[model samples]
Target: MPLKQPIGQKRLTNVAIVKYKKKGNWFETACYKNKVVDWRNGTETDLDEVLQTTAVFKNVSKGVLAKEKDLVDAFGTNDERAICTEILTRGDLQVSEKERKLEYENLFKGVATVLSEKCVDPNTNRPYTITMIERALKDVHFNVDPKKSAKVQAFGEALPLLQERFSIQRANMRLRLKLAAACKDEIQSRLAEHKVIVESKEADGATVAIVCQADPGLYQVLLALVRDLGKGHGHLEVVSLAVQREGMSGEGQASGDIQGILKEQQRASELSQVPYVTSQPASTTGRLRARSEEDSMAEVSYPRGPISGIPDDVTRKPMFLEIDGLQPGWEVELTKRGESGVVDAVFFSPSGEKVGAFVQARRAALSASKKAAAAQSTVE
Candidate 1:
């Protein structure tokens, strides 16, 4: 006896079905057993063989044939159901293929654009070119997913691997930083966490000047830190750069060349812009102050406390008086002067608020004498 095939057993193959409208009634056209339906030409060859193998027709014997009502109920719209049926059954095959190809190409381009924008060449700090990105994609042999958008495919599958294969190198750079006195401690603490080398530090009054060497990537991190801690009052300038290294092996020669290049770059930068001269005070009030254009050019000075036992001249003159509670190094402008003299010591708060000022008695007297001489000369 021959082996029995299972009951209700059916051969399985991918089927293509098209729903279409005939007059006013909904109908479905199908290709079965891998039959090649010429969708573009609206032609079907081997109709007998296709009908014999079609799954839908096989189910017709079981009273499972779908009617126009079923199509309407499933799609909820005659137009939509008809269009779907037409696409499945007799839509232009060449046009559909072209659309699919266009979508795939568009996705590829989108992925390339994203990679270019998001990832940068580490050495140049610039984005990779489209060609370079394409080459990278090729190297990775990335597969494009028809169901997903190009950006999704690039980010999800290609970006990480491409970055790994075409990595960028970190550059060495020198930075001149002007930190607010209030945030000095915090900035210093954060800098200590990185491999930064402090070349010099100058504290005049409320402003501190810091010259340091670090990787270029760390500059962004420091900027964020400054903006947060200094409340937008901190400033930084790149003084020099040691771009992506060349293959020079001798330690001494490489060091000498690097130093020479840095000097040249620094000189060029200085010639292009005004140099920043920092003056930090001995103590700070922990408040950030804005620096005006005029203030940048102003000369910064500190007050000298009265010498011990050299009692202030009560009879000769009482010059400038010191204001308590004002942080040192605050910028001061002389606004008023005694009739005979010029103001001596002026003080300000970190936020540019004036504290107080005074003048010396001797200087007042000298100023009075000069006025007297000028008046006498005018009379003569």
Candidate 2:
């Protein structure tokens, strides 16, 4: 219902006049009842312009008035304002904004799992503020206006707000591709297991169904990955890798793309002799064995990816590693630089089992050719 009653001659002294300077223009936005209304862009001036501009909507409960009052009461004094301004100038606000963004990202990590687990209404599917929808949608052509960007930001600030249509669109795309791939793989594996020749052709450029003897177990695995996405990092393990064929006979047709890629993958997997995956443990056994062989004789160990040492208060970028039974004066090499240097000292921790190897820059090793050249130059 429209608020028809007029606030006649009622002087609102405590009314907040929020004047934000953005892109060189001052925007006077009046907030009440947690709603933002009556916005105008003009010169930054006293409180009169904001009050006059918003007087028409004064009858409507501006929800933000309560929040504004709370904020003012919390830190309204000149001293508190000075502290806030100083902190903002020193980039504390930027850091705080970054922390908030990080929190959003961390929360969004479980979204795929949540979506996969249950059948949700397409209409109910909305992009929560936890997901960076604007960043995801920046490349989308329609919502490129500056006003739209601000609106998106505002929506993001009030988190758990749903962008239903947008979420459904992306979710449907992800789900379709994922389910299709799983279906195809399951069908092919079952066919091969039953000694049936699984041949996929893209001759007509139509959607191809993977044919196999029906197995109820494969379907369960698919449901587990899709529905239990949040549990056991299920979403991460469920791979939906795109299989693309480049410079194929088709010019503009997407007809052969899916069929060709699937056939190729099927052929490759058959050749490699992929065992029937009854469980995660059986599937990982081979890979784990290979990794164990690789790391067996080595005293130092690093994870498969980058080994950036833990972040410290001083923000030092040096790499640090603690290995068990690391002997003193042994060379330690970080793989990136491919340099092995003699350890400066091997400090034993209080536990006595772990040893920390510290190496200086100068004792680094070089390739045989480099060493040979240096020796020849010294002789000369």
TM-score: which candidate is best?
A: 1
Angstrom error at residue 152, model 2: 27
Tens digit of lDDT per residue, candidate 1, span 96-189? 4655676567667778766654444332233344555665576667767754655577667876665454442223477878877767777777
lDDT of 1 at 148: 62
For each candidate, the alpha-carbon lDDT, in order, equals 0.46, 0.29
Q: Give candidate 1 regions above 4 Å deviation.
A: 1-95, 146-155, 168-180, 191-380
lDDT of 2 by residue, 1-380 (tens): 99899666645443433443322322232322111222222232333332333322212224222233333444453243332232222211112355446545433433322322211112212122212333323223222222232333333421123232122222221112122333444534544564432233222232323322112224445445444432332221212111111111111222333233233323323322454221111222343343234234334332222223322421112323322122222223221111111112223332333223232212221233357678889999
